[model samples]
Target: MSDPNDWDFFVGLGLALSSNLFIGSSFIIKKKALLTLQQYGVRAGAGGHGYLRQWLWWAGLITMGVGESANFVAYAFAPAAVVTPLGALSIVITAILSSKYLNERLNILGKIGCILCILGSTVILLHVPKSEEVENFEDFIIKIQNFGFISYVFILIILNIYIAFYYGPAHGKDNLIVYIILCSTIGSLTVMSCKGLGLALKDTIYRKKILTTMILQVSTTLTTSVS
Candidate 1:
């Protein structure tokens, strides 16, 4: 079922990595921009009208959507076997952008941390076998080849339990923009974590193919606020 026009392994991996990394960083970038816009007095309560008046959130979301959608298209043209591994570039992109654009600090330890993140993710994703990948799961259970994946899944379940039970009550409520921005980072972490689970499980395919067919799923949800 392979296409003659399909991208070679290296090219496809590069594109997928580029896509995931860019899309992931753009999440936090928009979060930061939203936080900034609130400082300029955009009320989330005003919804669409409030957001349009601010402009920064609008611009940030637009830019991020384009970057995100492009990856879906790119990955659609390639196999997920070659795509998911490359998406590990998210940690790299996030670290660099946080430092250079967000003024988050480029200290020695931070640099080392980012390098380690990129290096570790790269090794796991690249060396991991596509054949060993789960590809997709049926029902609520994932047929896993690794106990490491089982442990991670358990941990995620616990984390989700805690978030669902405690996070909101503990945080004591915040400004709408600040909360959404914070939640955006949280959402990215949740997604990257899920992707990490997939990687840990060596998943190679998506039932929905967000990197392909559902490119607009998340970012588009953000955009529909205006449309």
Candidate 2:
């Protein structure tokens, strides 16, 4: 296992940037589609998933899927640290699109804040370490079984359960941040599962051991389902 060459690195970067663009645009488009649904159909907050019937919503979803696919491939060739910070660009893009297309207002302070975020992301990207290729499934398993990682996963589970049973009913409806916290916490686990699955698939393709890869694939699937 070796570091990706310069060409692979740049290709991944380009894919990530493209994903940011598509994802950002999808946000605005989806919002518009939702608004359209709200005008003639039940709101999503009222237990309606009627947005599914809208072609615009479907288009937005397809765009988002494309973006995620690009992001998935990007991770194969680049470090998560490098690719993850680049996601801030999606926020910047969303803000700009929301203002232009959705008529959402951005105050001067907000503009300044967005600029600062971009600058911070750029600095992080510049200094981020490259990804080290894992040699095999055994090494990946060892890494996953680290005490610190296990503890972190345990804490996340406990917190997620607590939030679902206690904080969610009390404050989730009134507070947007509650759902954001839930998504962020659960998303960490999901991302880990996806990364493992991606690596396993890559290894399986390289090694051509179908039986072992099948087992790894099943385990990864179960991990994702459990999470």
Candidate 3:
């Protein structure tokens, strides 16, 4: 990864925020489409594929794709620590939009949850490093190979396996946290992999270094798969 200057950091921040906006709105669009589809066809939960026929659903899907692409690109320009925490903003956006567009009421708990998300993002933002630590893909590789990072990933994988297989089948439906933990653990690995891949892509584009990019891409893919 190149050293991200102030302009690059701000651009990354903008991309992250824009991604959240698109992703958050996509939930509402897709939900509204599903609700509308239910009036004419079977519910998707009952194995209906009727949503494919709805333009709103397609629009939402495309919007989500754009958001995800933006997020991936943001990793190239900013540290993952900075970009990842900002994802919480999506929850706040979704909650607000749900109340306004979906007729969903934000109870006290939901309101509290939104407030907490904002506060958490704010705290992380206030404390995040002004500059990224890794100046290049080689540095990223070294960091990922560190003992602490390896140990953490190992623990995450074990916890995910235990929760997904042992506890999930029994309590996942009733207890959301089990699945949340599973997803969060897996998502952490995915995000890190994404960051490496993003850096490789940027380096390839700007530096025209295909061989290093290939190696970095393969390394990231293998790391995520291992996790």
lDDT of 2 by residue, 1-227 (tens): 75455556677688888999999889988999999899888998898899988999999999998997887767655555666678888989999999888999999998998898799878976776544554355566777789998999899999999998999999999999998999888877766665566556656677775535554675577555854
Q: lDDT tens digits, residues 48-154, model 3? A: 99999899999999999899889888988878888998998988999999999998998899899999989988898788876788756777788988999999989
- The C-alpha stretches of model 3 lying farther than 4 A from their native spots are 1-4, 167-175, 212-227
Using alpha carbons, what is the TM-score of model 2?
0.76
Best of the two (2, 3) by TM-score: 3
lDDT of 1: 0.52
Best by TM-score, which number? 3
What clash pairs does model 1 have?
A: 17-86, 72-211
lDDT of each: 0.52, 0.78, 0.84
* Residue 30 displacement in candidate 3 (angstroms): 0.7
* CA RMSD, predictions in order: 9.3, 3.8, 3.2
